[model samples]
Target: MEMNIIETINRFPDQSSCIAYLEGLRWQNEPECPYCKSKRSSKRHETYRHQCHGCNRSYSVLVGTIFESTKLPLTQWFLAISLILNAKKGLSARQLSRDLGVNRKTGWYLQMRIRKAMQEGEDVSLFKGIVEIDETYIGGKKANHSKKKRQARRDNKLQITGYQDKQPVIGLLERDGRIRLQVVDKAHGVTIKPIIEKTVSKDATIVTDGFGGYAGLSKIFREHQVLNKDKEQYARGKYHTNTIEGFWTLLKRGIYGQYHKISARYLQSYLDEFTFKYNHRDNRLIFDVLINKIAAVT
Candidate 1:
């Protein structure tokens, strides 16, 4: 069955249900005191506080968590997370505020906190088999420009400018499999090559455009197929960068439509969020993963 906001509400309707669920996820067996790590804990039998028999102190489940010291209802927080997970393209703070019936400032803070919970990244092993790598730029358009000039600006924005002044993103995708993306400082050989080596298995075949930076990768990989886009030859046999290029389309749409304008400093966090969601696209456990993120941060 699909896990929806209603299911979350049904599963955790109140503060007590929220506490029980969080305690279950945080502590598999006996509940320990968060302050002293004592196993001698007793339920306050009052509100959402837990009492430690050893330390003689009371604590709520929200202590030291992302939800700590928050006055909003847990139902609202769960609804916010649900909205974030359900919206494939992402939602603006104003949209969230309207949907949740909350103030715009509260909605903004809620979204930022949810993004913090979404900032979980684990060690992903290198991509094996055929890997495609590419890059793209992200920014908004300005007004007062003619239609032809706007089109030209859009065209110029597609080129993968090195990571200096703008956000230079690098995408590596295993053919018919998972993908990895990162914001980099530059696209030069020194910067891109090590990333390729670290993220791709040594024996995997690599494909890219005829960028001189990718010159020496063939010595390490089984094959380094460079489809020179300048020469107008996009593919030869099974060599192409369509997978990684496809990621750029979704990313650009999300940035332009959802975020509007992303600061260069915080671009990678959004990139991580997109990568996490996309990597787990096929898994029905995405909500579970998001919950785990909350458990970690909280």
Candidate 2:
């Protein structure tokens, strides 16, 4: 069934229904032993457990998934997924906590686990066609700096500036296709060029702003189109970085408006969440796709 919050709540009224739904998604009708790869299992219907005959071990559908070891009901998890998938900006932990009737910490943990599943693995194919590349900074604005910090900057004593504190994120978008985002240390050629080479195909045309880092891509790609933003030349004929810039706008708005503040330690997860949504924007059954991904995760 096409699942949304209302349908999810009505369909999965209790834990048993949730378990059955998840089991169907994960194991089809045939259960398997997670401890040992044994397909021979007998269902203990009274306890809702699977007894593996080969391994003599009992397990549930959540055995190897993000839901493993979680004490929360599958109903709550399904609700969380619905909220996360439907939220365009994002569902904050505080908001999720209030919605799920759980503590903020639990809500935070749930969101993190779901975000982990959102991560795109390294084995995915590279992007092709006209690819737009750009980089942006994430975090609070420099103008919001405290007076004392501003004074330190004027005194020329504080080597660490507000700009340095802001996280650097690089984004690559395939026209009318998927996007790849990375939390980078710096936006220099040494860092950005290699990512472009590795992620984009040799036949793909590259487009970017007037950044010196991307100047060398012409030698490697079919064509490297540069928009001299310094002179306000954003587009010339069919060449422009508007697509990637649009993605940056969405990302920054989501970061500032939805999340408000994100620590550097977990910035990549936030990136993954946004990238996953952007990549799957066209999917009519995104919720099912996410459920399938959750079931597939080791």
**Judged by TM-score, which candidate is best?**
2
lDDT of 1 at 85: 76
Total clashes for model 1: 1
In terms of lDDT, the poorest run of 10 residues in model 2 is 156-165
List clashing residue pairs in candidate 1.
Answer: 65-298
Candidate whose lDDT is highest? 2
- 1-298 in candidate 1: lDDT tens per residue? 2267788788778877777777777776467777887888777776777789989898766777778889898878888877777778878888999999999999989877777676535466778999998876665444533578668757888532333245677888999888888777776788888888888998899999987888999899998999979979999889899778878888888888987878877788677778767877877777777776676532
Q: Rate the local accuracy (lDDT) of all candidates.
A: 0.78, 0.86
Clashing pairs in 2: none
- Give per-model TM-scores: 0.84, 0.93
